[model samples]
Target chain A: MANDPISQFQIKNIVPIEIGGLDLSFTNSSLFMVATAAAAAGFLFLTTANRGLVPSRLQSISEMSYEFVASMLRDGAGSQGMRFFPMVFSLFMFILVANLFGMFPYFFTVTSHIIVTFALAMLVIGTVVVYGFWKHGLHFLNLFVPSGVPGLLMPLVVMIEVISFLSRPISLSVRLFANMLAGHITLKVFAGFVVSLGGMGALGIGGAILPLFMTVALTALEFLVAFLQAYVFAVLTCMYLNDALHPGH
Target chain B: MFVVTPAYAESNPTEGTHSEAGAPGGDAHGGGAFPPFDQSTFASQLLWLAITFGLFYLLMSRVIVPRIGGILEHRRDRIAQDLDEANRLKEEADNAIAAYEQELAEARKKASAIAETAREKAKAAADAERSTSEAELAAKMADAEKSISAIKAKALGDVDAIAEDTASDLVKHLLGGSLTKAEVAAAIRAASGK
Candidate 1:
């Protein structure tokens, strides 16, 4: 029972607080999210504290990450994308740090949960919606109306675009949540196999070898997935920002 | 260190269902899957996420990014200044080199002109000395010629006297008292065509 793979994701309330029938207690997820935030801030602070001309290793990394997102925004959304750099950069740092931290043995993975990921996804889509409408007014609806479509097929295409636009948050949040959830679960399952197999005799220990190797391999894969997921998130955010900045196509 | 409250652990409502189901899809959040699907905890996670995200964004955009940007800008300015200074110094050096070369060429020209004038002066002095010595030699040759002419004239006069004595002596021997001195003198005057 204690080795239940799904049990790893159960939220335990460390500090319980109820306000007007709303559960606002700090759960294990909140604890790690706070920790992730602190770590992200601390990292930025430490790396940039001494901005040397000939940069130290950490300073270069700080600058490189800054440039990385900067270029991404520039390339994906053009000059107009610079406006949202703060939000996108902050999101990148937070998700990247949180995902990497979750790779540790006992750490809670905040991004693995749908609630947290959906909130972030909502934030992106909300910004896109609000900014697009604020800046472009009714012309922002052109985002859903593809240009140059035949009138006969326009109705169908518009419906499809509308559905897809509405599903942005769902898809965005689910992609990250599912990837993290599946990868971690698979890793945990393999680890369980190794434990159960090793509990048997010498012959069972020999069988456990395969699962151990798979677990190690999966850990490496999970690390790659962590980085890749963060990259995908940032890139998609930029693409969404592009739609808002240059509506229509 | 984590302090586990005894009351919290004892009254966990969702514990039995989670361990029993072992399925991420078993809880009400089962469809959503996992802890986030657990509706009881959604508000807290979202609330904390919002708070933390807002704080992080503010700190990153306002504080950290500007500090790094400022440093980068300062360094860039410094580098530009260094480059400009180096260029100015290089131009100054080039001008100095050109000036030095001009000075060197001028010195060379002055030296050659001095040598040329010295050579002309030495040649003129040599020519003057040679003309003066030639003039002195001509004067000496003229004086020697004049003295030789005087000697020749005097010798001729003595020769005439000697010749008359020899002739008188020879005549006395031949015709004992040949002729008197006046007669000889008249004979000599007639022979010289006086």
Candidate 2:
């Protein structure tokens, strides 16, 4: 058992092809990411295809997910946030499905990687920036200035505001990546114990039972973490968008 | 931690050799077994992020938003149609109720008029019947008066005849023979108190 638990996190190139000195290669992680997206699409399409007035189980799940995100956007960002419902809802579903896919055996946890989470955070932050400028023009810069600060402390307050604004991407990315990485590492560690301990005699087998129970409990906890991380990401996105829209508040 | 030491000792046969070799951590795989972070991974991550973000944004703006808008618009239209139908029905009900009330009022007035006409006709008939009865009674009283006058005339003529006959008979009995015409006349005249 020389296999390090962290060693399994290698990004192996799936399709090895070199073109024009630039290695444009798809990796195992990329494959899983695509699979996660495809799964999300198929799940939504199948669940929402009928969309009957009286919903079936799957449709109800889809609708509940929809309503959940919609309510979050409404509550977090206010009524104007309704226009962005589609984007936020898609974000939630995609992240949730991707996270769940990662929880499976032999699957890559895309969210555990810094790059994937950073990209998602950047997109959300970029959208806020673009929309804010587009909607309010030069006045969007006023978001960094506090209205009631004294003239001498204005620069200090503005610096603080800018620092907070700049930290959005890091905070968002780290929150998701840390949660995914921690949950996966914990599961892997416990699984290793179960295998090693169960190989021994009856007492070892009895001791291994604790690790098995812990694994089950952790798996359940991971599932909750998956949903919670997705929710946190979506709600934070809404909050950022709200800030962009109503900078004074 | 003690239990894990035994399991580790059993797994690695070179545990003693590694311990003697002055490796602080007895694990065969080095602590840095995890691959160092590659710059290429960061680049790939950035590329994938851009791709996904673009794709998702396109899908949202093109596909999802329109679908949601259509569904909401259709729902709004359906609600409006329902409300219009309800309003139309309410108006029809109000018209019907108003018409019913008007008809009821008209019917009541007509019924009262009919009753009044019937009462007036009955009074006219009763008045005619009474007048006719009075006229008949007056005619009957006149006929009874005429009959009584005729009966009294007849009784007076009979009394005059009886008186003349009585006077003639009395004169004849007193004289024991037939009296002369003049004397008889004179006696009749004197008896009659002429």
Candidate 3:
């Protein structure tokens, strides 16, 4: 609301309720996270409540998103990978809804926090580990070994693959968190200019037009980034799950 | 105005108070503090994320996804059924066209047979009428010949009389006096090449 660009990310306690010794207070971020999840789920439920042969506008949107996720999973990981559709689709919807909600004036961006993004990233990696081990046994270790390599150089290659495999969550989490955080910060900073400059006079208002235009353009870009990051996350999950499904490759 | 005003006021904060409240604890992050990085808030955010995400996962898997999938499957089945119906209709149309063409061809053959018999009847009637006309003309030609012969006979009888009269007149004209009837008769006989 004010020129403090970072204040938008401030997690103030909305409803203070502490458990035994662990503080379980509901904050603004928590509220938005719950809201995002609800909104994503509610949108589908409402739109698809009454099924149709020829879909309405909202029905078409719901169907299109469903097909889009279905096709993405099918392409990334074959037909067998569809078993994990709920998890991957939920993850995608949650991130997408959270990112899009952040674009609103006062709504909080849940993806901007490293903790939130990291936790989701860990969930993806954990799914890969558990599923891979459960499905393929010791062959899951083959993920850290290259397919076609000489025995002499295999050890060095294995170490590099292990590091890369371990760093997946770090990169995945930071990519989303950083993009959302930076985009929001830049938008807020420009928005701050619109307010401060408009306060001055007619000339200040005229100058404020530049930052205003920039904010508009950046918001459009952020929208693209929102959809793209969600897509990237889902596709990567499918790819990781594929490795779990077929370990050596 | 009553309903709309509060909604607007809730969204837009008066600048002085918002920034003042924001200033006291701008932390070590950078130009302004982002409270998400704070160690204290992590437990709550994580806890809520787990709960809400778990609930969302459950809701989507149990209820929402299946409905959409069923709709898609039903639509696919409908499209396939429609295609099958279209194919059946096309075959029926082709069969109808073939039947119509066969009927048309049979009708054409029957029409041609009727036309041919009609043409033959007209030709036979014309021939019969022509032969009858020709026979009538021949009978009339025979009758005309007979009548002409009768008239010719009458004319020949007059020719003999005329010759006799012409001979008598010639003798009278040549001589000063008239001859006796027997002498005249004898001269006539001689002139007639008796």
Predicted complex 1: DockQ? 0.35
Query: What ranking of all candidate models by TM-score puts the best one first?
Result: 1, 3, 2
| RMSD of each predicted structure | 6.0, 7.4, 8.1
In the range A22-45, model 1's lDDT, one tens digit per residue, is: 667777888998999999899889
Candidate 2 per-residue lDDT over residues A1-249, each given as its tens digit: 322355345566666434443334566776777777667666656665664545678866766676688789999889998877877877887788879987898888878887788888887899899989998887889999879889999999999999999999999989998898888878878887887788888888999999999999999999999999999999999999998787774
Residue B110 error, candidate 1, Å: 5.3
How high is the lDDT of residue A184 in model 2? Answer: 85
Candidate 3: segments with Cα more than 4 A from true spot:
A197-207, B1-34, B117-194
Minimum summed lDDT over a 10-residue window in model 1 chain A is located at: A1-10
lDDT of 3 by residue, B111-144 (tens): 9999999999999999999999999999999999
Candidates 1 and 3 compared: the better one by TM-score is 1
Give me candidate 1's TM-score against the actual structure: 0.82
Query: lDDT (0-100) at residue A131 of candidate 3?
Result: 94
- Consecutive 10-residue window with the lowest summed lDDT within model 2 chain B: B15-24
Q: Compute the DockQ of candidate 3.
A: 0.26
Model 2, which residues run further than 4 Å from truth?
A1-8, A19-23, A46-71, A78-86, A133-138, A191-201, A204-213, B1-39, B137-194
Error of 3 at B38 (Å): 2.1
Indicate which candidate wins on TM-score.
1
Worst 10 residues of 1 chain B by lDDT: B1-10
